[model samples]
Target: MKAEGLKIILSGPSGSGKGTIVRELIKKEHFILSVSATTRLPRQGEQDGVHYFFKTKEEFETMIKDDELLEYAQFCDNYYGTPKTFIEESVKNGKDVILEIEVQGALQVKAIYPEALFVFVMPPTLTELENRLVGRNTETPAVIAQRLARAKEEVAFYKEYDYVVINDSLEEAICDIETIVAAEKLRSSRFKQEIEKVWNA
Candidate 1:
């Protein structure tokens, strides 16, 4: 019997390099990065299904009311959520689905999918995190300050996750996540059918 794929919830603060790690993981692993649905309008050159499943505020609210969203959160006056059907179908078909979301939404998923693996990425130091934010040169000084303060608050939630990977080295961080996925695939709970077949034989 084939083992079912794992549902992985990967989350981190703004400057933790989680996005970069996810991109690398996709290249090396048989994983599908879940596309999120958002109420925000598409920016220039953004596609509906590829970038985000764009929806009107009314439609998004209806989904929430109907329990179609696995997890949803409001950010910058816009609703962003994981559609339940896509993830359920992908995992059932033996595809490891990675949901890269913010900590708030990740915790919401934890409540609904307790069996899912939750991994939190962290920077080596808060100062380093600040530096990375500053290095971007995209955000203003006020925005960077806000992000740094939020990063400190997010650090406290590390204890809530099953695994915390300190992303001091990008290569090392990716390796650690890959290791986690490989070990999780071998977990006894994930091989119930194989175990039963051998025992019955």
Candidate 2:
């Protein structure tokens, strides 16, 4: 059997650039992005199974009761979660799977899948994070302030992750994350079966 691939969780605050980093990281052939399920209606141009597995509230609730979700959370009255089965199957097929999630969902995933690699993406500083949110210009001053405050609280959980990468430079941050994935791939435990086969042969 081929060696199973790693399960990596990339998490951060609202304006920490998690999406940008993931977009760059998946440009490499070895990484597979895990699509999450949501109970919310799809927005303009969002496609089912491509953007998200749009589920009915009842269906999502059923999944939760059946333990089908790897991790999930309710935000602003909608449910969002990562489905467990496909990720596990992809890993078993020797494909590294990455889950981009928020802090609470990431922690929930960590509790269930302790072996998964946890990477926390950070802003250069809280000020930089605030600046990024303001730069978006999509929210009011009040909403921006709320996001910054939530970001401060989220940073408190960064130490819990196995690796922390500061998104000071996009190129540097992408390189750092790629390095982490490459290093994890070469970890001894990942090749135990092959090692044993070599010894026996």
Candidate 3:
């Protein structure tokens, strides 16, 4: 079985239901959501250290230089990264840390934690993704176009991940993710040492 503190990655196109799935999973499951640090201006209702830890570009650069970030990248002139310290502490506290990072960041995590579960969430179709993006009512038309283009590029990297989950139905997608977590908890690698302990005891 997998350990109590596994790092799970959820990635997909911008309009895909990955965020919704992640939110529901957090509400129902035992996992810690890893908030990202960003140099970009937060949109409406986006809180610092919650949605993202808002920082200046210089601060972000310093963190990178200090190797305080596990993985980081600049997109659309904004820098976003995950800090390593909180993730380590979360695991030590027996909480599985779920990182909703970009595909590139997920690749970096693969190198460091190959056993980490990689989930590639896709929408029902590209058309559906477009519709969802429009429905958000947050981005301008120009921003929507840019995001759509970026999503197309991002979705192409889905093959690099271990699992592909289609977010056609919210309930179904959430169920699949829950199932994956449950199965991961039963992995031989996770339970082998503990199995011996149980028998020896």
Candidate 4:
């Protein structure tokens, strides 16, 4: 019997390189990156249903009312959420769906799908995290400071995750996650049916 694909929740603070990690992971076979839906206007070159399933505030609210989202959060007056149907369909077809989300939304997914694998990515040190944020050069000093403070708060939640990967080296971090996925697929509970088939054979 073919085993179903795992639902994976990948989360980290703003500067932890989780986005880069997810991009690399999706390059491998059978891994799909779950796209999110949002009420925010599409930026230049962003295509609807590709970058995001762009929606109006009223349309987004209807999704929330209908419980079509696995998890949703409001940011800067816009709602961002993972559509439950996409993840469900992907996993059913044996594609491991990776959801790169905030810590809060990740916890919400955990509550709904406790069987999912949860991983928290982190920088080697708090100082290094701050450095990465500043390296972007996109935000002002005050905004950088705010992100640093938020990082401290978010890092504290690492203990809630099943595994933690330190993103000091991008290649090594990617390898570590791949190893985690390989090991998770071998968990005895996941192979129970196969084991029984062999035993009966």
> For each candidate, what TM-score against the reference?
0.86, 0.85, 0.76, 0.86
- Per-residue alpha-carbon lDDT of candidate 2 for residues 7-34, written as tens digits (9 for 90 to 100): 9999988889999988988888878899
RMSD of 2: 2.6
> Once superposed on the true structure, which residue ranges of model 3 sit more than 4 Å away at CA?
37-66, 73-80, 137-143, 197-201
lDDT value, residue 63 of candidate 1: 95
Looking at model 1, the pairs that clash are: none
Better of 2 and 4 by TM-score: 4
Model 4 misplaced regions, further than 4 Å:
39-48, 54-62, 74-79, 197-201
Query: For candidate 1, what is the lDDT?
Result: 0.90
All models, RMSD in angstroms? 2.5, 2.6, 3.9, 2.5
* Candidate achieving the largest lDDT: 4
Ranked by lDDT from best down, the candidates are 4, 1, 2, 3
Residues 30-125 of candidate 1: C-alpha lDDT, one tens digit per residue: 788998999999999999887899999999999999999997789999999889988888889988899997888778888899999999999999
Candidate 3, residues 1-201: lDDT per residue as tens digits? 336777888999887888888888788546779978899999999988778889999999999999999888899999988888878788767787899878887888889878888999999888898899999999999999998899899988988888889999999998898788778777887878789988989
> Ten residues in a row with the worst lDDT in model 4?
101-110
- lDDT of every predicted structure (CA atoms): 0.90, 0.89, 0.85, 0.92
Go through the candidates in order and give the clash count of each. 0, 0, 4, 0
Answer with 1 or 4, whichever has the higher lDDT: 4
* lDDT for model 4: 0.92
Superior by TM-score: candidate 1 or candidate 3: 1
